[model samples]
Target: LATGDMGIANTTPAACLVAAFTGRPPEEVTGRGTGIDDATFERKVRVVREGLSLHRPDPSDPLGVLAAVGGLEHAALAGVILAGAAERVPVVLDGVNADAAALVAVALAPAARGYVVAGHRSVEPGAGAALSHLGLRPLLDLGMRLGEGTGALLAVPTVRAAAAVLRDMATFEEAGIER
Candidate 1:
């Protein structure tokens, strides 16, 4: 399973969600999406802060927080992540939107964190914040911000290689190697 998104200004809600979950200030989590101008960036940060202030979503209640601040794409992505976790499938996360949804999914099921894989380091600050909160180290850091699962797709090969190694590599004991 992999999560990605194609939404306009989706990072605004993601920034709000990250702030609500991590208790970080909005400015710290907000980023300029699609290379917005300086003024637009400032407004984006303000919007995130206002949304957080208005909602005051509780981190412990993931559903409530998501409902209050999450966008439709975020909700859908979170559901995908939850389903993947329940099925014991690895869910590769793309950028900020996917990362925010993963936070919601993990909050609902703490064990779900194990199923999540950070595909890349998004240029969005919220993506980094959410990854840190989930204790996930991204497999790639290409400074990528394009969603649509581009980053996750790029990381799939690496993930598959790692799985192959784990499945086929012989242990030192099996190889009879001394120390």
Candidate 2:
């Protein structure tokens, strides 16, 4: 399974989710979405702080937190992650939105953390926080912040190539080569 998100201004709620889960400060998790200017970036950070302050979401109760601060897309992506975990499938998570949702999924099912693979690291600070909390290192980091699964898509080939190398590569003895 692979996860991606496409929505405007979704990073605001993502930062909120990261703060709620990781206990990070709003400004620490927040970032400029779509290249906003100074004032807009400042306001975005403020909005994230206000939302977290108002909601006071409990990370232990992921459902309650989602209800309080999650966007519809966040909830939807969380569902995908949960479903993938249920089936013991590895999920490739993309960007900040997917990272936030992955946090929600792990909170709901701690074992689910093992099933998530970070496709790539986003420039978004929240993405780093979420990946760190999940103990996941992204497979790629091309300074990507574009959602819509572009990063994940780019990572799929890498995953496949790695798998192929593990499965098909021959050892020195198998290749009849001297040690």
Candidate 3:
């Protein structure tokens, strides 16, 4: 519901949660998305703080956490992650929002973390903490914050390359190398 609440706005609950999880006020962690005026930024920060304080969902219970403050998009992304994990497919996480959803997925199924791939690093401070918690080192840092799965889309080539490597690379014995 948080994303719905901030429709067309850059201020997302994932962004706010990032700040909260990192123990920083929004002023410290919030990026100037689209260059809001100072007054608007302050208000945005206040809104984030209020949202977090109001819910205060425990990280251990992802369902409760989602119902407490997350939006439909977050939940949907989490379902996607879970489905990928179930199918044993690699799932690329895009940005802070994806990271937040992945956090929920991990809480739901600890093994899901093994199937996740961080597509890129987000400028959002909360993203780093979530990445660290998930033990995922992002594969890229293009300085892009487009969210909307753009990062994951860009990571496709890397994923295909990894698969090709595993499938086509010859073993030292097969190549007749004397190690």
Worst 10 residues of 1 by lDDT: 1-10
RMSD of 1: 1.0
- lDDT of candidate 2 over 37-145, digit per residue (tens): 9999999999999998888999989999988988999999999998988998878999999999999999999988888899999999999999998999999999977
- Cα miss at 108, model 1 (Å)? 0.3
Over 4 Å off in model 2, which ranges? 169-179
Per-residue CA lDDT of model 3 for 42-73, tens digit only, reads 88778777887887766666788777767777
TM-score of every prediction relative to native: 0.96, 0.92, 0.85
C-alpha local distance difference test of each model: 0.92, 0.91, 0.73
Which 10-residue window in model 2 sums to the lowest lDDT?
A: 154-163
The C-alpha RMSD in Å for every predicted model, in order, reads 1.0, 1.8, 3.8
Model 2: which residue pairs collide? none
Per-prediction tally of clashes: 0, 0, 2
Candidate topping TM-score: 1
Q: Is candidate 1 or candidate 3 better by TM-score?
A: 1
Top candidate by lDDT: 1
